[model samples]
Target: MSQTVFCRKYQQELEALPFPPLPGEKGQEIQRTVSKQAWEEWQAQQTRLINEKHLNLLDPQTREYLMEQMERFFDNRETDQAEGYVPPSR
Candidate 1:
């Protein structure tokens, strides 16, 4: 059976991740608060940010930027977007 958590992003109980997505306190907080679905969504967005912005994750600055974006993402705060990105029409 899958675990469930009170997802801070979704504002309700939902399926939980088996482990934290990152290391240290932020990862622990995500484990306790973020849902699996939300994390997956962030992964997709992160990928877009990487590809569109040509972010080199190997660089410390890029990694730090992504970390901050990840925090804002889970907290439902406004996050930076890839330059020239256009949302697909529904």
Candidate 2:
């Protein structure tokens, strides 16, 4: 089940306590919160891991195209290193 569902269920149980918590009860809630947080953390980490490991493999033409795009971007940019010519905004 989703973390929200788990939290809601456990929260209901905590609220149904006989009286004030016995000090450590709050720790249980904190642990559940950490676990839910870790689940999301690990999920994002897994996505990054998958992309880094497998999904981002670049073929030759793709790499060439990316390089061409970068070159084009920098080509249109001006710097003091250029022939002192200012770029006109189109």
Candidate 3:
């Protein structure tokens, strides 16, 4: 059976990740409080942020920005978006 957690984003008990997405306290907190679905959502948002903003992963500033966004994302708070980005039409 999959591990379960009281997902902070969803406000319910749900399946949890098998391991933390990062090291240290933040990752531990995510493992304890974030759901698999929420994590997936963050992944999608992270991708969008990276692509839209043209972020360079090797840059420490970009990584720091992403980490801050990740925190806000899991906390159910608004995160910064790539300026002037428009969603592609379906």
Whole-structure CA lDDT of model 2: 0.37
Candidate 3 segments exceeding 4 Å error: 82-90
| Candidate 3 residue-wise lDDT at 53 | 85
List the pairs of residues colliding in candidate 1.
Answer: none
Q: After best superposition, candidate 3 residue 8: deviation in angstroms? A: 1.0
Compose the digit string of candidate 1's lDDT tens values, residues 1-90: 899999988999999999988899978888999999999989988999999999998999999999899889988999988888887999
lDDT of 2 at 47: 49
Predicted model with the maximum lDDT: 1
Q: Total backbone clashes of model 1?
A: 0
For each candidate, what is the lDDT?
A: 0.92, 0.37, 0.91
Stretch of 10 with least lDDT, candidate 3: 79-88
lDDT of 3 by residue, 20-44 (tens): 9889998988899999999998998
**Candidates sorted by TM-score, descending order?**
1, 3, 2
Give the per-residue lDDT digits (tens) of candidate 2, residues 1-90.
233323332233221222222247653543443334333433454444345444343577644543343333323432122233243689
* Predicted structure 1, TM vs. truth: 0.87
TM-score pick, better of 1 and 2: 1
